[model samples]
Target: MQCVRPLWGLTAAAVCILLLLLLHCHMLREGQLSAGACEVVTLDRDSQPRRTIARQTARCACRRGQIAGTTRAQPACVDVRIVRSRQWCDMSPCLDHEGCDLLQNSSGWTCTQPGGRVKTTTVS
Candidate 1:
């Protein structure tokens, strides 16, 4: 029938589109293609490991149901530096002071510039 010919054409087109979608999903799962996943990683330098930093999780998909390639986000990051707060206080007062033409007062130091006003800094 003439009507059957058009129906067959539409069915073939639908089948072809469905097959393409299935193949795409297969490729993604096999890692031949790329997909998005959240993970935490550390930073390293010259084969040496450093301190642990914040854990960042990134997603590639938007609300519209789309997938992004893995190469776009490989989590290439750097290490974090951890330092003690007390170590900073151990340094001398003169080392921390700057831009002072003179030093005065036993409890605090004065910062002054030529022909400028004087500022006092108390040691904490």
Candidate 2:
């Protein structure tokens, strides 16, 4: 019985060490110290009271060449190239006085202005 207890203790200690090593490896792969460490700043304005509220919310801070994942509940960092693979017209729309058209190569979409200039953004 004494030998069994010692063996169990050793097994438990090994499992704990393995878990810690795995967690450290995951953190290193993500290039973050810990999960939920990054924060996003949100600004809210009340028109009636003419007041502005600034709040810091927890979010995955993506590194360069990375973007926020599509999931809202558990967002993670994703490569920008994955986002670019999506259809541009599905995500972007043409603004007023601009004509929306698809690319000739069918690679993406484009918005052209009345003055023969290209529109890159929408009106706020």
Candidate 3:
């Protein structure tokens, strides 16, 4: 009878330990599941304003005859090369006149001019 009682107590202790271990594992898994709620915030405005300025300058210089130091009522510097395309030309203004060209090529909308010379101004 003594041997049987000690064996049963040992069995009970073992079962209790197993249950505690299972509970600990479940709590750990639940904590990990909710951990995804923690997130990292990011800023997307990295040098975007500068890139926009450079792109605008390139687009503006592509127009025909809107170069600096020329006084003429020339054709519209900005032209829609293709009606279907949404690409539009953007040019920097020089002496009350802005020069830009929207030209559609086979690959895509390509704005090209000589040496990319334009009157740079601060865009507010």
On TM-score, the candidate that comes out on top is 1
Candidate 2 at residue 43, lDDT?
38
lDDT of predicted model 2: 0.55
- lDDT head-to-head 1 vs 3, winner: 1
Per-residue lDDT of candidate 2, residues 7-87 (tens digit): 999999999999999998998876653443344445353444543333223367677886654222223555677566654
Worst 10 residues of 3 by lDDT: 67-76
Clash count per candidate: 0, 0, 1
Stretches of candidate 2 exceeding 4 Å from the true structure = 32-124
Scored by CA lDDT, what does every candidate get?
A: 0.39, 0.55, 0.38
Please report, as a residue range, the 10-residue window in candidate 1 with the lowest summed lDDT: 76-85
Judge candidate 3 against the unseen true structure and give its global Cα lDDT, from 0 to 1. Answer: 0.38
Off by over 4 Å in 3: 33-124
Residue 16 displacement in candidate 1 (angstroms): 0.5
How well is each residue in 41-96 modelled by candidate 1, as lDDT tens digits? Answer: 34343332442322334333222232221122232111111012222112222223
Give one digit per residue, the lDDT tens place, for model 3 in 1-124.
Answer: 8899999999999999999999999996664423212212232332553353332221123334232211122212333333223333332223234454433342222333355544332221
Error in Å for residue 118 of model 1? 47
